[model samples]
Target: MGLQKYWRIVFVAVLLALAMIYREEAERIVNIVVSSPPWLFFACLFLVVAEFLLQALRMKLVFSKNWAEILRAYAVGLMVALSFPSRTLGEGARIAVMAKELKVKKEEMAAYVSVERVADVVVLATAASLVLLEVHPFLLAAAVLGICTFLAVIESDTVYRKVSRGPVPELLRKYIEESRKIVKDRALFAAILGISVVLWGIDFLRMWVVVHTMGGTIDYTAVASLVSLAYIVSALSFLPGGLGVYEGGLAGGLVLKGVPHDVAVAATLYERLFSYWLWILVGAAAGAFKRENGSSSTA
Candidate 1:
């Protein structure tokens, strides 16, 4: 980690300590997860393994023609993603690993990784729309309806042709053409989208299990949307795997949806146990082994 990140974490830790001390309403978060049933604890473990498998499948699909490299790159991506914040560093880290393992160019790897992240955006938007409908019905419904009408118009060749002909300069035209090529590649888009949906679904189910264990009244789908929004916020926060921010967002979302505060806190803690901590332990071990085996780059 960089010095900047180190200091930011320190700052965040201090702030978190203050938050815990001053916020009288905040229940003891860690204690709740500790008291959850053994069966539920195992369920969390199952979910993490499922999450890793889904990511591996996503990477494999991202590079369909290069299955062998995909396997290596996927593992590398998971390691980096779990070790860092929001998986933001995952692509570059994977590219380095791919270069060593498969002698591939970083630029080519970048094109695939870029497309992979765009897939994530599309999935998040879809999840957000679903969640908004559940969490904020009126506004979400209007937005969804308006977006659907807009997409329908865009999908129509007549509308596209009309929009395409106008004041487009040469440079802008080339950019548009390239973008069209990227978007129109149905196989590539399908692979990315398919894997992303599956990954998110597993995560949602994991969240659902936590609520079930806690005996919370919130529905599975409702928990899913809340998970989606919490994920988005955590991504924006830039903390490693979103750390404190993610847990806080999960708890807050549940409270907003009328869950009792203690249950929300317990559920969020359980989520960390099953997902974040698992990733940290596994990814860190993989990273350390790579270093010892001289399989990783120091640069």
Candidate 2:
């Protein structure tokens, strides 16, 4: 195996070692999972499936494509994102699928996908800000959104001219210009953000239902930020599916927010079980069906 693959394996091994360290808690976590309500589990699973559809629609709104094709592309990306440690594979898959399926220009696809991620962060942080109620965090989120907008709004030709004397690459120039064009589309920009809010809102509510089913209750508004922050923490370490790390961060965060530690852990694990591991399983099934059906003519 290549050194990179070896490193990822080592990270997985580290994750395993950490799980062993918490072996007893892990056992209890397992029991809790085994006993979770079957109906509730299915409901949460349905929510996850719906969330995927909504997410694909969000992407399509910003970059026009047949919805089925875009969804297949996202499923392919999700499969790799779940199976690997690196975060970029899914993005790389997204670009490749769009190029292959939608004939989207690579640079243009990159520009819009990058913007979509920034917009996702903005929208989630806004949801987080909703319950946080702290002016400083809201201001910080606003600053982040402002910077992303600035990048998207900057005149690429002017930027290139200013740095033309430098060693900037042609590809970077194209990407920047594409981003500028995408963000300048006021209608598309508004549509993307609007879709984003709804997307993240549903995502947070999915978690709320899971927690509620587990006999834990939380402030309705806090669900958005809690869910957002938990996910943000999971992605931060670049571990595929966040594995053991998400449990700690999520449970700890919930404990700080007044949930009993045991309840917090149970809720986190249940939600992750559905949203992470089961998500990968569902993606694989969907991908198989897509392949068997061939690309939809509509796609």
Candidate 3:
């Protein structure tokens, strides 16, 4: 974890250095970026909204009710995660909000969130592995390994038994057992994974739209690989919201893939504007509308 911290810091430093050296190219890109049409701007916003909407949908699928409160908690928690150091705080905030507002027990909620994240890793890594096969073989291999590793950890009785013997109070045993029960309902599990895929697909499309809005073009397959690459690299960063690392990886990756430097930067910024900044704005509103804490409902 410490090594990952330094790696993120180093990634930022390196990206900044590259930006400085290519200042002229970046400026020209920004010039073109400023001319994006309003329709395209709104289209990007719609995709961003859709992404979170799907996220909310997934939460509802998992928890079944108290949706209004769940959505609020998710938004506020997302805000916390993005605003604070230790991106893990975002997950903590979700658990906190649900516990405070919906009367969800911490252990069960923690299990829900953990299960979701592990499932996400498997889905994304598998997707990235396949998409990157021709573009980046090493990353493809790593992604495949990540999928396998996450599954192995989750499925291993040895890991569960070992944790049970340790100081972990719940040992996630209850959570894991519950998760198994949930997945046993095939229809529900499919719906959840389906929502997740769509959510991430919107994310990719959001970036693609931003690039097109900025009058740039790249192959869809390559763009998907790049987007997945950026997400994979930045997801592990300890940086608050994976801030610079995500943007830098995205913009830099596009440029490396033959996109004009300025346009790549512009598209990345626009995508982040709607997805990250606007997302926080909505979360802020959700937090404000609620009581200082959340209201309880039967979920």
lDDT of each: 0.65, 0.70, 0.71
Ranked by lDDT, top first? 3, 2, 1
Collision pairs in model 1:
none
Q: Candidate 1 at 70: error in angstroms?
A: 4.8
**lDDT for each residue of candidate 2 in 1-299, tens digit (9 for 90 to 100):** 14435554776587568669999876766666677788987788778777788778867876677777788777766665666554566467657665655667788878878777777877766666644445366655664677665664454556646655567788777777777776777787777777778777777787777677666768767777777766666665555655556667777767777876667887886787666767566667867786677766456
TM-score of each: 0.70, 0.79, 0.80
lDDT of 1 by residue, 1-299 (tens): 57425744674587578658856544454455666788887777887778777776665654444654555545555555544554465445655665455565555455555556666656665777776666677755665565455435534557556657877665444434433444457775687678888888888888888877786778877787788777767766555667667888888989888887878977887687667656545655655666676754544
The Cα error of candidate 1 at residue 9, in Å, is 5.1
Off by over 4 Å in 1: 2-28, 64-72, 82-102, 130-185, 295-299
> Candidates 1 and 2: which is better by TM-score?
2
Clash totals for all candidate models: 0, 0, 1
* Model 3 alpha-carbon miss at residue 26, Å: 5.3
TM-score of 2: 0.79
Which lDDT tens digits does candidate 3 get at residues 1-299? 35434644675687578768998875676677677777887887778777877887777787756778777877876766666545676567666766565566776677666666755665666656655776678976776677567556656778767866777656466766566545556786677777877787777777877776676778766677678777777766666677777888988988887887778988887787776677567877887777544344322
